[model samples]
Target chain A: MHGLFKWSSKWWPGVIPLVIFWGIAAWTSTATVEGDLAARSNAALKDTVLDKRRISVDGRDVTFAANAFSEDGRVSAVASVEAVPGVRLVNDETRLVPEAKPFVWSAERDVVRVTLGGNSPLPSSRSKLMEAAKANLGGVEVVDQMGLARGAPLRFDSATALLLDQIGKLKDGRITLTDTKVNLSGMARELGGREAIAAALKNLPEGYSVAVNDIRAPPYVFQAYKDPVALTLTLTGYVPDNNVHAAVVAAAGRKFFSEKVVDNLKASIGAPSGFAAAVVPALGALSRLSTGTLVVSDREVKLSGDALHDAAANQIRGGLGRDFPQGWQYKAEISVKPASAPVDATVCQQLFAELLSKGRIRFESGRADIVSDSAGLLDRLIETAMRCPTVNIEIAGHTDGDGDEAANQTLSEKRAQAVMDYLVRAGLPASRFLPVGYGSTQPLAGNDTEDGKAQNRRIEFVVK
Target chain B: MAALATFFWGWLLTAALLGFGMGWIAVVHRAQAVSKAWMRWLALLAAALVAASFTRIVPGRFGYWLDLFLVMFALYLCGCAIGSWLRDWVVTRSTLAARAAKSAQNDNL
Candidate 1:
């Protein structure tokens, strides 16, 4: 053992450097082989219609496991790998997934390319399908691997063409034709796309019918970007119809005083339930913000802005959600605007008028009790009052000629006092406000209709 | 007594090897735990000191001190380069292996 140790000590040091050099050479060579194999395999299979491909190298032998739609693809991949210079052998463990039946033909679209696969009845039909896809998709790559098969139903070309037309309307999804029974599953590119396709399918050639339609319409989007500095509200996205469009524009007009409404809305179908109910109140909330955005996508209302004050911000955050229709939700990102330089009494009265015009303070019928829904408007009034700190204002309450003059005057007085009391409780000085009642003496509109009466009975802030 | 002193230098070299080697291993195994670059530099300095002591390229105590300081700086730079290369290699290998495994599993399905 001692002699053996002496021999090993003498020879091992000399052998050590050689062993290390050989190890490095082998490691580098294997790394090169691995890298080369991966690159070559990817380049060869990239253009082929293979579903899944895995390439592994052990020495010079390359193993490929993949799924191919056709046997030709599998064979081609094996041949290509075998021809690569360093590869001694190719192991192809590829599979072929059976196509679904009644010979379903489908076109699938994604961000970049549209893949048209499945069975076609004739070679001419296949070419025509590819031509149509290329024509409609506009610069998107069209991959065609449609196979010729029998058993296509009567008027197959017409049905397939109809389905292909519908595919152009999809954002991402597949449309399939199974023996003249069509199945479509995907997201529509725009609002009312599903409805358009459904309407078109009703005119399909006789004997063809829809089996399943899983197509979904895009979100009912209503977005208004309020640029306070620009004094403009740019309305974009879809509204249900021309009437709804007109209503929304009028609502914007009522809420945003003197600001230009840049209407860029498209009239489309499929407005969510209670869309009007949600959007009208959302516009009211948005009007209270200094600069804000209101985005109503489906039943979700998202309002974000800098409010005029802490009271306005708190009211918006707390009240907007509850005002929406049942099952409607809201998210508010409200921040209080910095205190503005105090304005003169005249400007303060103008601001107060603008606030009141957007929304009204309400009271229980024939009583002085304020409705809880009027909190948002009152908050805005208080914010305006705080801005004009040096000014004293008279809270004048008016009534329509509906009740006795004495009772009307008393009720009006009590309502004006209620307004003053609310402002005082909200941290404003009571001395800054004077309550006054003008009974049924003066009217802005005729008191014949309810709307006219509603307009006549209002609370006005007159700067003193 | 002289032989014992030489043995002490050998022991110091061993300690230096352990310091740098263990530091490298720790960095590779748990990158977040040993994130400070200074710790890596200190370990490299320890390693270089032992190497310089063995080489004895300079004469006397001043030479020893100079060798220690200069070699520390030089090896710290070398350590950084080696550590970066090793880290990249490990990460690339892991990513490629994971991709290949996923592909193989999908192909099997």
Candidate 2:
């Protein structure tokens, strides 16, 4: 043992990281598979939307009894049948509901995007818009609005959203469109400062400074980094000025613990129990946090910031910190804020059984590929798309800073493209889908740790 | 890992022996010991690689960490080994010729 120790002292300073890398690689390598083939074609399924159908059930014909038909080949509709429980050989026609098509469903016929920037309307404004679009995106079809509204100037929310969308699509970290209302998130102080966020916001259409308040210190000072993040703390009540340095360090450790937990949950907690299990350990430092409420469960776990007294029973799961293997923020919020928040009740029952997790399907690290676990959630999205007939989708991808800027850009684009491919394969109109990638320039969450990174690597759906 | 051992172990051992021999020569002849010092570094790295492979069979989390450290060091040492070997070779060749010429010239004197 002494000899071994001597050997280690002389030659093995990197053993721990290598082992960790090896173990994690082993655990996650099993996670990837050669494309888990979505049934290529749904020929067996029926698509009878707008097509007339006559069916017989139990030797009896049922005509027009609240009939249902879908154009997507996956979903099957059954004839409605109400029969007495004890009756034998009752004549009833009930069709199986058709499997939903993997695409975005649109409800409106005319979804128009009016871009005000570079809006020098030509002699023919309608054709000009189409020409401008065709120059950038060839073969994209647009239905002409019979009477189009005059394009308005890009300002506030509109400009911010457009710029934010652009910033989100820039994989190389240079494409930025900043606004005061727009907030760029996700960064660890150790790697770089908040300058990237500031830089992103600076490039907006004159007079818009993006918001970076999320990383700044609170007014009363619940948490403060002594000299910007090498040390930080979140103490209850107030900071004792005399022991500020030590107190901050303790708080930072707490914060780090909680942040890691949140990120882990954000990444893969498709179930309520899994969310609780992922979050409990991070909360130990936040003693005041007793009853944690899960605001959103299923594939996406948007934890609620509520007290123990107001915690939801099944929604608040506990003891998942064992798998955290990372750190977090101090004095973490117990649940999502606001009592009136809409909490999905389905997740509390079966965590992995995702009903609506499309909101937070994150792409994996340094790549555009959706995580393996995203299949079920993405499938649900495809089903919803099939049900909604006329909608067009913008498959937008986002990333957090943890790699080379160029790589981040490529990954973001690739991820969006992946979603597009999935939707098209699922029988959505190829023309209806748009794929775009936003690198680490735009962030919904802080990009400082494992947790924040997980939150930032996500895709959004804008119904057009 | 097994391949790394077979691939790099002999060269590393040779570097270690060359380094030890050079150190003795440098101290006796007032020559620089830079080449020798680097050779020892290579030997230590080779030893690390040998130690790191134990992770494949080792139990416990701590062992895993240890294995990582060992592998990194072994790889680093291996990188230094080739350069160190060439340096030692150059030094020994120059010193041997110098000693032989000096002895021959002294005999004539």
- List TM-score per model, in order: 0.56, 0.20
* Chain A TM-scores, candidates in order: 0.67, 0.24
lDDT tens digits by residue: candidate 1, B1-109? 1211231233333333433343344334433332346456756875776666556544432333333333333333344334444545677799999999999999999
DockQ of 2: 0.01
lDDT of 2 by residue, A120-149 (tens): 212244355445444433343433332222
A305-420 per-residue lDDT for model 1 (tens digits)? 98877767877899888877899999999998898778888899899988888777789999999865565468678888998999999999999989799998998899999999
In model 1, which regions exceed 4 Å deviation? Answer: A1-102, A204-208, A343-380, A390-392, A399-403, A421-431, A440-458, A462-464, B1-109
Cα-based lDDT for every prediction: 0.74, 0.39
Q: Write the per-residue lDDT of candidate 2 for residues B2-105, one digit (tens) a residue.
A: 32233234433443443333333332243333354665796777566555544333333333233434543445444334334444567779999999999999
Winner by lDDT: 1
Candidate 1: pairs in clash: none
The ten-residue window of minimal lDDT in model 1 chain A covers A5-14
Q: Please give the distance, in angstroms, between residue A376's alpha carbon in candidate 1 and its true position after superposition.
A: 7.3
